[model samples]
Target chain A: MMPDHTIPPSNIASSAARTVFFVSDGTGITAETFGHSVLTQFELRFRQIRLPFIDSIDKAHDAARKINEAYTNDGKRPIVFSTLVKHDLSSIIRQSNGMHMDLIKTFVDPLEQELGVKSTHTIGRSHNVVDSEEYKNRIEAINFSLAHDDGQSHKSLSTADVILVGVSRSGKTPTSLYLAMQYGLKTANYPLIPEDFERGKLPSALPLFKSKIFGLSITAERLSEIRNERMPGSKYASIANCRYEVNEAELMMRREGIRWLSSTAKSIEEIATTILQEIKS
Target chain B: MMPDHTIPPSNIASSAARTVFFVSDGTGITAETFGHSVLTQFELRFRQIRLPFIDSIDKAHDAARKINEAYTNDGKRPIVFSTLVKHDLSSIIRQSNGMHMDLIKTFVDPLEQELGVKSTHTIGRSHNVVDSEEYKNRIEAINFSLAHDDGQSHKSLSTADVILVGVSRSGKTPTSLYLAMQYGLKTANYPLIPEDFERGKLPSALPLFKSKIFGLSITAERLSEIRNERMPGSKYASIANCRYEVNEAELMMRREGIRWLSSTAKSIEEIATTILQEIKS
Candidate 1:
């Protein structure tokens, strides 16, 4: 089969089309995520493939055969990003006709040297070892965020580590989930509905958790765009309504002395980490 | 300040306590996530500090000073996991009294050699570059997942890339969200309410999108435990109710020719990737 050269050529050199593989004994997410980060530095594009849960010898052999096939068909050595933890499996993958970049084996030597110990050489432990206390905390945090989403429940507000208050479509749900998932922090987000804005004060449900409340605000243009996607041509999606709600929400947060930040031009990671830092401070 | 040695020393050496820092020009999440994956190979404890948004010279200097302080306080060189893209900022970090593992600078030269192209060497480009068309798709996916969560809306069911169904608290919401966040796939998740179980069949709304439907099931005990946390001692949390719901949901999915998997022992990453593979196949 001919290689795919349909990707628009740019400033980067594209002498040959190459395939990249993310192979792991577990979810392959860490390998794929970090490999993508490193690959972003280079301008060349790749046909990315993910092969996860290569825990058995048979699976490892199957992955090797696939990688070898790509190498021969593409007329170039494919790049393999791997996190196979077992030594035998790593050896099997290393024998493939590809540039095997094994993150686990590459770092294990130096870590053992630095820590003065032998590595466990265990597969899937890092990804699936969720029976510990830390993992349980993460699950509990996830449950908290889901229950408190959109102010669905308020019975457990006192248990919340942080409560996010924002106008509708201001990027509250994703931010809340990210914070809980990454930092194991129980986050609850409440939307500022027309009733709250009409009251000209912080919502009555918020006073009990005043110290734990943080606010999220967004640009009127962006808010209107998001709302319009859901309910086009409605009053809620109008630019004038978005602006009015945004202004009133910001004023309410300021009057209540609740810290607020704009979600405009920011990724969920950026928003979550900023909130985590503020909460720590 | 005294070093923290409260961590139980096992096979690994504990000559001195060390502080690990995840430094980045943007959110520091990619750096932290990948660094933690690498660090898991060893059995040592670390005090992790994240210093993000170090985009300027002043912030880099601040981060260097913090790393230097940690080195002196801990009486050992701290381990720094950095994705600093700019040469000048990275040089500042290198000058600190720490072991700086620069993912960008270390791999860029080798990749340039392999690809025969110079890297962009741009700061904060890897994680924060989201203005492209790909990013717009991610936002659309997130919005779709939110709208369809808990079967809130079936208006856009036809547009979904994957529709997930499960009993309440069977790990549908987070899996759907993760699939959207990572893969830019429009995912919709529905909960099998009591009424649906009574009907003894898949929901009528699901049959039209039968090809896109995936079912998630969990152990009855686990489901009961999860539900009990929210509505303790209620019928919804009763072990008998949970067992009945899970059995009915599984049978309904099987009878409808829908693929189903258990979330009892799998992480969200694992579940999402498995479903992605099935969909692709």
Candidate 2:
């Protein structure tokens, strides 16, 4: 028999689980992302905390105090993944009773040597909306995506950088939004319904932007499972219906010469990356 | 006179702008993000490219070929920021004509030392949807945010982790989506309109979720600029109307004892982080 691994909240302090902190002078998102990736390599549980916007010396001291408190409470040194840009703030954080991993400085020093230039040592420059033009484009792309979600409108169909077509619950909407949010690409998605299958043609409006169209298909079983969660005990959630829909969608895509991929085992990030490579190439 | 500084596309080959590649076995988002942060510290122009899903040896060889081709064409070594996990793939890429930056292994070695455990060296684990429960929650959050955007529906209001109340164009939709996408927080946003202000109370539906609400206020000038882009020369876009809306929204929030912040000069990440801190605390 397998051993039960669940620990009660009261006994969590003595467990092997470690407390991890992602500390930064900005949103701390970069630190969290890189740290999370690195942590995933281990088979350990982490009670994660984020301390963002620690730009001032006083805030640094407070963050250090929190780290110290965590260390004292855990009876083990906490690991801190820090992306603090300023030297003084990092120095203050380093004084805490923690194993401080200086994420930014470690890479920055080597990069400075390679590039033969001094780093700006600037704070909060990575994700700030300082480039107004780029920021405006991103917001515009988001609005464009929202306005065009699920074939909501055909008014701006001509303006989309890419258009996605798929049956319902085949992962179109999320991919559209991610493409827009991450790459600033104006994306519109249309549902490939029974009506389109019956007509044996692409949606009338989609033909105009055929070159910008991509299709997403999924396994029938996966589609049925997803649909059953949303609408149980209905034909829309039946395995047979899902099979029909997926088959029809794939046939239509093939007939129209539209490139397509299956989203059954892929994340939205993977789907969006593949679509970007295809459309941009 | 100031220098023009603009290089034509035809002359880009001879210019100092170097080509940079983000190569990874997964989505390559972490590589791009960390590399971008590192590059932002330097004052240089880079033509960025993303090579995602390079998990196999053949793909690694192809990526290296591309890097070498870029080096030959540009007469300089292209900078490659790589997050490849397999040592063989990394070695192949390391042999390319680019200055390869092993983003993952560099940190992974130190992490193994700190944690006293060997890494799994998994490929495509960072952004893949292997954790089914977490992935489902994220997708649910996205759907919840979409269903509740701009106060579209009142169903499941109680399920929201946070509700944002703001005047139009004060940056609600993007923040809600970001919160949902990044943190799996089910967020709903309601617009604080003139109707609510005229009534001298919170929206009838909002008061029920007041404890979960956060307000966003923006500068009148900025609101006007954003509105003008949407609907030019209209009463809605006028500065006076914007000032009235901003003032009334602030008054309503203050009267209702709702926590609020200005979204005028902040990114969605910053706004979301601030809200997370306030609510999670």
B92-154: candidate 2 lDDT, tens digit per residue = 999999887887777888777876777778886633463356777778889999999999989
User: Would you give the TM-score of chain B in model 2?
Assistant: 0.92
For model 2, name the residue pairs that clash.
none
User: Could you give the CAPRI-style class of model 2?
Assistant: acceptable
Runs off by more than 4 Å, candidate 2:
A1-14, A126-131, B1-15, B126-131
lDDT of 2 at B246: 99
Model 1 chain A: lowest-lDDT 10 consecutive positions: A1-10
lDDT of 1 by residue, B15-98 (tens): 555688999997888788777777766667777888988999999999999999998899878888888889899899999998
**Model 2: per-residue Cα lDDT at residue A115:** 64
For each candidate, give its TM-score against the true structure. Answer: 0.90, 0.93
* DockQ of candidate model 2: 0.40
Candidate 2 C-alpha error for residue B271, in Å: 0.8
